[model samples]
Target: MEKRRIQIFDTSLRDGEQVPGCKLNAKEKVKIAKKLEELGVDVIEAGFPISSPGDYESVQEISKNISHTTVCALSRAMEKDIKIAGESLKYAKYPRIHTGIGTSNVHIRYKFNSTLDKIIDQSMEAVKYAKKFVEDVEFYAEDAGRTDNQFLSKICENVIKCGATVINIPDTTGCCLPEEYGKKIQFLMENVKGIHKVVISTHCHDDLGLSTANSLYGIINGAQQVECTINGIGERAGNTSLEEIVMIIKQNPHLNFFTNIKTQCFADISRLVSKYTGMKIPANKAIVGINAFSHSSGIHQDGVIKKKETYESINPKDVGVNDSSIILTARSGRAALKYRYQQIGYFLKKNSLDLVYSIFLKYADRKKEITDKDLETILEKANLIKNHSSRLSSDISRHVI
Candidate 1:
């Protein structure tokens, strides 16, 4: 089967910067934009230009320099925002205007104080207005997760008629489960007229910790694009983490899906975003987390040391992680201890290994780990008692822990 390639629309620079204290200057945004292109994202959403002068400058500068990926600028349904989005992305060889208004009842009634009919009309007008500036106009009906499915289909139909090349159905509040979100996509696929005219996209929030699941569901049902940020960091509960979604796609090979991402660049980009945004990557985060590749328990450690596939389903290297980690702790097997110890240049036979293993167990029980330094101390004492001091200590003094 010839599987359709999914378009990865990275909003790390735009939506990611929306989180408090995540403001990146124009220089930083351009630097990251280049990296996103190299990492193989199809579209780099630069910023909401009219939101602020800094944002506009970042969008314009990124559009000017980033040539590989289609540079995108976001906007509301208002003409000024769409105009600014268009202007900001104008310098790029490939530019797109992402503009739209709210679609849910709460957003229509409370946020905009507009009726459902007026909201649909406004959405169509926004898409038409955006089309004037660029051939590629993406219309996002914000809070589509909460909007009525039939009405949402109607709005998407109207927007497609108005020249929208892409229709963004966002779970703005992250209120819907995966099944419900899949149903929304299915409904649109079944109901929307001229559905093939535009790409179906999903932009989900992680308020309920289900954004990635919902996104996957959408893709399986009908969505062709996934809008996400790095490290699951964004407004409120954050959007889907780009690394998470990409890993999921890669892991589920039976689904016959693949992204254009360079898997080797995942960890490096995650670090850069974390450092720049001052949002530390949690140790337990899937794919890019510190412990994601570490094997700790004695049985698991032995199994992994013998063969990594015995314990881990996905290889760490597949997602750009450098190597599998073997920590010398109370739970660590003798195989892990021997391999880690040999790095400091100790060659022990089976009988000698038992002695060291006994000492390691004792040391491990006292401390959380039996570090290289502790091993050195143990070896030194045992050898000194035999009036034969070790030579490894002198060689490793400069690189002391």
Candidate 2:
């Protein structure tokens, strides 16, 4: 089967920087934009141009620096926002303006205090206005996860008619189940008129920790584009993780979904984002985390040591990591201890190993992890090398006699 190309719309700079203390200056934004281009992102959402002068400047700077990927500037469904977004992207080889309004009833009632018909009019008008500046305009249905399917379908149809090339259905509050989100996409795909004319995009939040799952289900149902951020950094609980979605597609061949992302660049970009954002990637984060490929459990260490595939589904090297790590801890067994010892140039016979293992258990109990120096100290305290050398000499002397 032919694999469908999933467009990777990386909003790391725009959405990711929304996290407090994660703000980047224009220079930093440009640097990351170039890296995103190198990482093979299809689109880079540079910033919300109308939000601030600094953001507008960053978007313009990114547009100037980035050429291969489409540079995008975000805006609310307002004329001034769309105009500023368009002006900011004038230097981009390919530019897109992402504009949208809240579509859910809760948003309509509490946020806009407007009727559904007026919201659709505003959405279409925004898409039409954005179209005056860029050929590629993406319309977002904010909080569409909670919007009525029929109303959502109506607004999407209107936007496409107004020249929206992409329709983004954002689970704004991250409140939808995977099945519900998927069905929403399916509903749009089945009901929205002129839907085939525009690419359906999924923009999910991780408030429920289902952003990746929701995005995947969106793709399965029909979305061709995914809006995500590096390290999944964004407002509140953050957005869908670019690495997670990309790797999931790459690892699951049966899904027949592919992207232009360079899998090998995952580690570098993950670190780059973490460094600049001051947001540390959780050690247990799925792909790019420090402990993703580190094995410490006795059974897991043994399995990984013998065959990497036994414990790791994804090779560390595939994502730019050098190799799997064997973390030596109190839980580690003989196999792991022997492997770690061999790495540090120690060979032990059965009796010698037994003596060291006994001491190792007692020593390891005092620490969370055992380092190579600690292992060496334990071996020296046991005096196994000296004893083994004496035993060898005695055997030779006895044989000669």
RMSD of each: 3.2, 3.9
TM-score of each: 0.94, 0.96
Q: Which stretches of candidate 1 lie over 4 Å from their true place?
A: 381-401
- The residue-level lDDT of candidate 1 at 141 comes to 90
Candidate 2 minimal-lDDT segment of 10 residues:
392-401
> Which tens-of-lDDT digit does each residue in 1-401 have in candidate 2?
89899999999999999988777999988988999999999999999999999999999999888878999999999999999999999999999999999999999999999999999899989999999999999999999999999999999988888899999999999999999999999999999899999999999999999999999999999999999999999999999999999999999999999999999999998999899889999999999999999998999999988999999999898899999999888899888888887776666656767888889999889999999888877776786444422433221121211
In model 1, the clashing pairs are none
| Candidate 1 global lDDT | 0.87
Highest-lDDT candidate: 2
Find the candidate with the highest TM-score and give its number.
2
lDDT tens digits, residue span 1-401, model 1: 77668889999999988988778999988888888989999999999999999999999999889878899999999999998888887789899999988899899999999999898888888888888899999999999999999889889999888889999999999999999999999899889999988899999999999999999999999899999998888899899989888888888888778899998898888898898889899998888899888877888888888889998877888778878888788888788877776667666557666777887788888997677678777665544222224344332322222
